[model samples]
Target: MAVAAVGRGASCNAAARDLGCATSTVVSAVRRYREAGRGALRDRREGNGQRKVDERFRERLTRVLQRTPEDWGWCRPTWTRELLCLELERRGLPQVSVATMGRALTSLGARRKAARPIVQCPWPAWKRRRRLYELKCLHAHKPPEEPVLHVDEVDIHLNPKVGHDWCLPGQRRVVVTPGNNQKRFLAGALNVRTGKLTWVEGKSKASDLFIQLLWHLAGEYRRARRIHLVLDNAAVHTSQKTRKALAQLGGRIVLHFLPPYCPQGNRIERVWLDLHANVTRNHRCRTMDQLMVRVHAYLAARNAQRSASPCLRRADLRRTA
Candidate 1:
């Protein structure tokens, strides 16, 4: 309508007054209509007035992104989009907006991911021991009659696990967590050969709880002459009471300790990871009983799946006397 009024020789100011817009808006619209015809009068939805970031500028930005902000004499360890924009402008490139910088970075295949915590194993001997254990388990002439079980304990708190969930971009997800700090410790053993799991949940992770788990394992594998239990060097596992319990079991159970601070060596650690991902991550259980039910259900479902697999059956380790 503004363009039609201007085409009829109405002044830009008169058109603006009629259309309830600024004079500049009418003038610009008339110019667009004259230059590109009626197509320009219609809203261009493709570009949305955002300037396309240059390819050369993107390459330069990617190089900067590959390095920390400290490399550019900034006091920060990481780069924010605002910081990158400032750096780009400082380097005599086009003054890019933060949103444009983000788009450019994403186009360059860069992503925003949380940093994972890593602990470098101080003892290289642990790697060698782990490799040896794998070889013995995999390529032995005959399967070991005794089951090899990886044992570990995981503490589940009443507090909700803060994790990623489907939500609108730029919106934070709020998970309701109770003030009560009630916690349960699950002492679990994963059978390496049969892929079976046996676990006991307790209010506290103590030597007594550890001893009880050991007894439970003993009863679970009573037919086998000996069971090889791979575990970590937690204080409770090596305590005097635990040793006494092992002595009482005679030669029926043997404990193999992984190197200190080496959780990756315990296969049961992977089970805990799966458990958290399936039952606990982003979950808010109302009560301790509900949490226990969820945990038990997860374990039971896993055991059922394993039991169906013919390859994961219990090994016969008995020898003729």
Candidate 2:
């Protein structure tokens, strides 16, 4: 307005009065308009200026961030923002603040993620055992008269399973959980041939529960001449009572124990993950009975869909077989 008024032959003092500003302000605006045109009239705050660490240094940091701390001769398995800044200094690079380092890492597709714990096998024969198990799984599809099955037990607590969920920014989601310490044990078997699930829910995963699951499996695949059951080496599975129960089956049920600490070799482990993701994770059932009902319903729905459901199909034992 000041510039337009001045352009129309109004005096600087008159233009300032019309725009509600001092004459010096009007003179400054006129000078800016003449020097840089109308864009200078817009309000713009001054920035903090260029980053301390330039693009070249950030490129180097990205490469270092791609690797583990141990890869750089550090004893630690992971990297922290503070440690990363220290590393930059040690490597003769420009030092950055922890906050700045975090931003740089994020721009390079890095994220602050929790490490997933894995069971390590210290046994020398672990490789051989794993290979043997893989071989069994590979050949499990053969022999149309018999089918292979992977069985395992998963424990679900009355406490709500906390998992990721979308929420408002800077807010956390709260899930209601039962105060009483109650748990339900689920013993389940996945059929490699048909992608069917045979399961039994109980209070405890004891030898008796395992035996009952085995009987259920026997009843499920009654037409098969032999059932090749693959399971983990849980204490209950190899107990004296379980041995007696196996004896009663009379060679109809052949049990194959996976290598110790190698849950990855058991295909049913994937099924349990699917169950938790679908029926339990981020879910809050008011009562244990309600939780059980939901679990059973989820299992039934998945079984009905069979290969059609994404979760069931993704974890399909038939693919492993």
Candidate 3:
């Protein structure tokens, strides 16, 4: 507006007043426009001192982030802005200030986050990869008569699951606990194709909990010749009692165990996570029964939304004594 006002023969002081800026600002803009004909309006900092965080520097920073500080002979395990600056300088790059390094990391979409603990799979790399490939092929190319399900178990407690929640600044949200924690367990199976879920609850996450889920699946998928259950290798799953239950089923259900500690392969793990996030996390239910009711309601709604077929009948979700 200032530039246009000046172009329309208005004085610098009038243009500055109309644009709510100082007269000197209007004068400088007009001088640049006259000298370079609009190109001068572009950012003047383009050629400012050789770019500190150029493409090559960003690539090196990314590589450095992938490794630990120990790899660079630093005593610390994690990287800080000052440490990052020092590391970059050690790599023969131009020394940048801590603030500059912080801005560079922000530009690279880096964030300071708590590191998650994970267990490494004990199987050899080749064996693990081959098994995962086999499972993938089975899931993709399974016969129509055979149904594949990713199975897993989760625990529910009367004591609310503590997780991140939104609250006003300087205020924290509180979830009252039951004082005495009461727990229940759920074993669920997620359909690979239809995304339907079949689950059963029990007092404990024992072999019977898994067996109850197996029976529930058997009843639901009666038409399927073989119900292939992809599950983690939990001890209860491979227990003698579980084996006996499978034997009684007469090969109608087949258990395909995933490599140890590989929960990512089991799709049902995501369902349990959603269950916790939506129903169990920060819940205020005072009794296990109340909590279970809400859990059941959430699962039923989820199944209704995901399954084109009819939802599971109420009796099917009965808790095992």
Candidate 4:
């Protein structure tokens, strides 16, 4: 109340005159304000926040990730969320949260390793221009009635993708467990227009395997007059061997490459996400053959959807597919 009065330019004598209270109350409030600023208005019991990890702690964490976990007095060589926290605590840092450790590891480049060696950090400028030109050509023209298939491969992990469980606020949940064991490989193509899908189980994602899938698609969509293909700029996709094979198809198809780092523009990317969510997440397959069975079932289901809600009008599918 005194602070409120002070805000209104109420002098101590003026406050006393107006409220019939002692002037000492207003004087004390103004004096506290002059000494402490706005923070004086807040309750003293409120905590500020968690103490930050110091530079010493961050360096220690970097060192921990640099070596195998076993080297740091741990029995195992691998790093796990639980083990990271325990190690930090053992090293004299206050217990760090799993999420905090995860972020720190990422900053220090300790997350997933690159899938393959990158010969060049950045591609040549002309290479970039050519890719851009191809993308521009793709984006400017609407797909003809036939579908443009962007084929890709994803590993089908054996482990079930457990859904997030309910938890009280501020509590933690298990992120990973040893129980997951099933895994397989998935090769698929996405139709852009109606968002239809077609894919298969594959032995490998090698260049030959990819070409075989293309051949299968060509045979399947034979009655279709033309196919516009959108592919990534992968070494295998543009290799001389792959080109010679694609060229053998005559002028029946047009192959266009998407710009690097621009997978979001590919509708098939979303299809992969959907398949992972709906079909693969809960699946637990022991063998490649068993995983193939489930994959075929999922593919048939997707095909059924395509038949019911045809991705594009025969004309549109013919053109923009």
Candidate 3 residue-wise lDDT, 1-321, digit = tens: 678998899999999998899999999988998899888787788877898899999999999999889988999999899999999888989999988998999999999989989999989999999999999999999997899999998999888889999889999999898899899998889889988888898998888899888888889999989999999989988999989999998899999989998888888888888888887899998888878887887787788777322244445445411
C-alpha TM-scores of all predictions: 0.65, 0.71, 0.80, 0.48
**Residue 207 miss distance in model 4 (angstroms):** 1.1
Which number leads on TM-score?
A: 3
Pick by lDDT: 1 or 2, better one: 2
List clash counts for every candidate, in order: 1, 0, 0, 17
Candidate 3 segments exceeding 4 Å error: 1-48, 307-321
Which tens-of-lDDT digit does each residue in 131-165 have in candidate 4? 76765566457555566777677777656676655
Q: What is the C-alpha lDDT profile of model 2 across 1-321, one tens digit per residue?
A: 899999999999999988888999999999999999989898764565555677877788887878899999889988888989988889988778888888888777877788778877655686758766674754555586788888899998778678998899999988877778589999999877788889998898799899999888788778889988888889999999998988998878888877778787788888888878777777777778877777776677678777423443333433332
Q: 9 in model 2: Cα distance from truth in Å?
A: 25
- Which residue ranges in model 4 land beyond 4 Å of their true spot? 1-146, 161-183, 306-321
What are the runs in model 1 whose C-alpha is more than 4 Å off?
A: 1-34, 37-74, 82-101, 118-120, 124-144, 167-174, 306-321
Residue 67 C-alpha lDDT in model 1: 82
lDDT of 2: 0.81
Check candidate 2 and list the clashing pairs: none
lDDT of 1 by residue, 1-321 (tens): 989998899999999998899999998998998899988888776666655488778878888887889999999988889999998888888887888888888888898887768766577876857755763564243246777888999998778677777889889887788778689999999888778899998989999888889999999888888888888878999999988999999968887777777687787888888778776777777887777777777677678776321122112101100
Candidate 4 Cα RMSD after full superposition onto the native fold (Å): 14.2
